[model samples]
Target: MTTNNGRAFTAPQLEGAVWKKSSYSGDSQGQCVEVAALTFAPFAGMRAIRDSKNPDGPALVFPESSITGFLADLADGKFGN
Candidate 1:
């Protein structure tokens, strides 16, 4: 995922995306992040969430199916946090 200027961080390469820390991620050692899908590229409909501190770091892109499932699980409290 590393590019010459920096890592291109393409949508497909974000499965292992590293996230930045958040105050809400307290004691998580920066294990969480805040990401949004950039609207200017073909990456639309694709997610690009990443750690806020490392703006250039990897991102997390979840497919529609996967994201939907995750949301359903959230509603059902599958992981129990």
Candidate 2:
């Protein structure tokens, strides 16, 4: 069976995760995002992303490798602005 690691997790499911936002989000009105590192079972080494404005909302979880690669691509401007 193929395991799906990327999934949208509920607030309660991520209660143990520590969320953090970007430093460049200052003065941005409702345009900030937060990321948390998951350390529990079935979520270890995973990353969770969510809107900073909605702390109680669902969060998208991804593997550490995926998040790292995505950040690298982002830094390389893979997704043109």
* Candidate No. with top lDDT: 2
Candidate 2, residues 1-81: lDDT per residue as tens digits?
222556777899788899899998986765899999889887887889999999899898888999999999999999999
RMSD of 2: 2.3
- Relative to the unseen true structure, what is the C-alpha lDDT of residue 62 in candidate 1, on a scale of 0 to 100? 51
**Residue-by-residue lDDT tens digits, candidate 1, 1-81:** 222222246445554433334457776555567656434334445545566656656655554455567779999999997
lDDT of each: 0.54, 0.85
Residue pairs clashing in model 1 are 3-7, 20-51, 35-49
In model 1, which regions exceed 4 Å deviation? 1-31
Residue pairs with clashing backbones, model 2? none
